[model samples]
Target: MGGDHTISYPILQAISGFRVVGAEECWHKSLTPLMKEVREQMGDGPVYISFDIDAIDPGFCPGTGTPEMGGLTPIQALEIVRGCRGLNIVGCDVVEVSPPYDFEGTTALQGAHLLFEMLCVLPGVQYSR
Candidate 1:
């Protein structure tokens, strides 16, 4: 978690005029603690959540390079994203999807579906190609 935030800090710092703080492990049992800390440190800025489905439990989404056990469910993940309502979501991406690893196509399918769900939660403003 710290590594991810460390890598993301510089880019966010460049785009926004504030320093990015807090390193929350998305797969942790309680997401609220991490989220609260981020909110406290960052203070309600536009938040773009990059969800790597691999972070979810393999049973829930068995398609990714590294599948962790006991990760959040799809619904839980979606809720986390939705919970950040009212914050500006500039953009998002769900990466690390190696289709070869997903024998049943469940992972890729869910990945695409979740992308649509995320779009729905985004600002109503239209996007151009």
Candidate 2:
């Protein structure tokens, strides 16, 4: 539930099981509160992060298939990931990065950066670089 303004019907149907927090909702509220709700829902279980590059604004990440405007900035994205700190993150992934559409590889770099951010929030992972 990141930056999907024009979500298709099929995709909507597919994500019915997820608790979607829309882009507007994210903009209007702080991520900490939303993440608190998520934590309550998740209850003490291991978490998995599936980060879509398209969640970021095209201005920051132009390599995704469906680049949407008014999306999260890189800093905002990192903060959202950071909000997962103290959770039991067992695994994570970053997806929907199209290198062919990237400008000077900025999007790919951002994807990597996001991955790093996720790793930083994991329970016991130690990263340096």
Candidate 3:
């Protein structure tokens, strides 16, 4: 949910069929509405969720190569993922977790939790842990 200005908008826009939401939009707006818009944009297509740990605030997840300051809080991150409840999700991945920079594995743990949250929303998936 966090895309610092580091991403090249021109290149992202050049992609044939994709939507890009910047961090500012995510931060300022309520996640529920934002996510509703995302769902609308995605339509009925099968979705693949990809979460980068760096999308979370460094205060909550500080183990990535590029830790951006103004990022999503752990709760906010989860809420956003949970908001995808009825989407047709096919797969997902959480990346950019570097244990070396993590304190007591907080980042890793959050990554796992986020993954679980994502799984709970996917079709036919039940969270066991």
Candidate 4:
């Protein structure tokens, strides 16, 4: 689960089009509404989530191959992943973590946590709530 931003091209080839909710959008909009757009486009179809590590600020995730100055917060990351709770998430991944760059392993840890969050949002995972 270490996808790079460039990986999107291949993924896009499989679909007709997509909506870009990059760092700029996440800064102003709620992921809930963003997820709604996804739901509207996907229409109960099987979905795959590919999260790139560099999407988060380098301060919080500097171990990635490309570190960006301003990015989503770890909390916002959870919001994004959690936003998929009701979708038919066929598969998901978090990529772009370069271990050598993050000596303390925080980036790796963020990747791991993102993976865990992805798992939690998959269909058929019953919650006690």
Best by TM-score: 4
Question: On lDDT, who's better, 2 or 4?
Answer: 4
lDDT per residue for candidate 3 within 36-93, as digits (tens), equals: 8777877777777778899888998998878999998887798789878787776666
How far residue 105's Cα lies from its native spot in candidate 4, in Å, is 1.3
Evaluation by TM-score, superior candidate among 1 and 2? 2
How far residue 23's Cα lies from its native spot in candidate 2, in Å, is 0.5
lDDT for model 2: 0.75
TM-score of each: 0.65, 0.77, 0.79, 0.82
Point out where model 2 deviates above 4 Å: 1-17, 126-129
**Ranked candidates, highest TM-score first:** 4, 3, 2, 1
Alpha carbon lDDT of residue 69, candidate 2?
Answer: 94
lDDT of 2 at 124: 76
Query: Global lDDT of each model?
Result: 0.62, 0.75, 0.77, 0.79
Query: Considering only N, C-alpha and C atoms within 3 Å, which residue pairs clash in candidate 3?
Result: none
Worst 10 residues of 3 by lDDT: 1-10
TM-score for candidate 1: 0.65
Instruction: Give all candidate RMSDs, comma-separated.
Output: 6.5, 6.0, 5.7, 3.0
Pairs that collide in candidate 1 are: none
| Model 1, span 1-129: residue lDDT tens | 111233465347435444432224444355555555545655556666677787667897787888877677776666656554545667666766677888998888777876766676676645332
What is the Cα-based lDDT of residue 83 in candidate 3? Answer: 77
lDDT of 2 by residue, 50-120 (tens): 78889888988999888999888787787778877877666667888887899689998998888878879
Clash number for model 1? 0
